[model samples]
Target: MIDKRCSDTELVSLYQTGNEAAFEMLLHRHKSRVYTAIYLIVKDRYEAEDLLQDTFIKAINTIKAGRYNEEGKFLPWVCRIAHNLAIDHFRKRKRYPEVTLEDGSQLFDSMRFAEESYEDKQMFRDTRSRMRDLIKELPDEQKQVLIMRHYLQMTFQEIAERTEVSINTALGRMRYALINLRKKMIKNNIAYDENFYPKRFDQVSIPRGQQGPDERD
Candidate 1:
């Protein structure tokens, strides 16, 4: 198992060296804040989760493409991704009065909004279903923390008090829960959106050993 204590820099270095576990650690460490940030903006549980997965996919694809440049500030970068995506989501909703599938892709061979309850939006159901499946695999303690925090809207202190664990311990369980869930997702090739991202993160093909800093992250 990768050490949970590794700094962001160390973890990134390991991830750059082709360690997916290291990336899982990074995801675990940062997921809650990213989820919370998106939820605060979108104010919907399902859409917030959809954006959360997009943000992670963006970061992961960027890292794999060797475009990730973070001078030890991974969390901020992801949080920014989440914030920007959330803003984009709001703009799209305002600009277009219809609903697209998850990641806001309409199935009429267009990225625009689709008719309500359209069959083409089936991909969104797949996305949510996949996430639900992985969430079921979380350990009992971590599941409690996740439900109380995300579902019950409890703060860390409140969760700790209710669970009779230290705040750090409660936080740790949540982190592990995220990591475990993500591991299952990756294993199953799950994504919140079936469509490829608009960004060029997918087009860049850099091998692991060839990745080097091209700009300040």
Candidate 2:
């Protein structure tokens, strides 16, 4: 049996060694957030599903090419690909909603000292498990807003366009998301670690491995 507890990096290694189940496990594990990310942009279940497949296909191609290199950083990398593809589709159809911001400034607060977050850590077991617990409780829209804003660094305008809501509404959803997250953390007594979560949304500056986190990794 495939060890479902394997780290994403470990799963990628196994997949590269001809273990097809490893890729399946990786897909099963991350499908929700990945699909959610795409769904938010496409806003149609069927189209999102198709885009999801296309995203994974691109990811698999990258893996086969032996150029995949995001390593432990899987979800964010693939999520980016999905987001880009969705944007391209909108552009091609000329169906993209207009947004007010084009200055290209970042919308998130950068986490300083993030490098020390897991310096002494041995595993993601505790962190990922806790995150799953918190995430599952969030409403779908709130979850989508949070994912795009933090992980993708999506501007509020872009989020509003993709979600088919006004900018204020997108901002409101993000507000509620943080409120819900805080409530969940307090309810579960999960101490707020500034670095623990934000590090997951980091950009591609960190050194990468030979296995990349594709569209759904």
Top candidate (TM-score): 2
Candidate 2 local accuracy as lDDT?
Answer: 0.67
Q: Which pairs of residues have clashing backbones in candidate 1?
A: 69-217
lDDT of 2 by residue, 40-124 (tens): 4554567779989998988888887888899676676778778777766665555424331233221111111112224223334
Q: Model 2 Cα displacement at 200 (Å)?
A: 14
Backbone Cα, N, C clashes tallied per candidate: 1, 1
* Per-model lDDT: 0.64, 0.67
Of the candidates shown, which would achieve the greatest lDDT relative to the real structure? 2
lDDT of 1 by residue, 19-125 (tens): 98998877776676677555433535688789989988998888878888978767657765775576577666664334333344321121122232343245446
Off by over 4 Å in 2: 100-145, 150-217
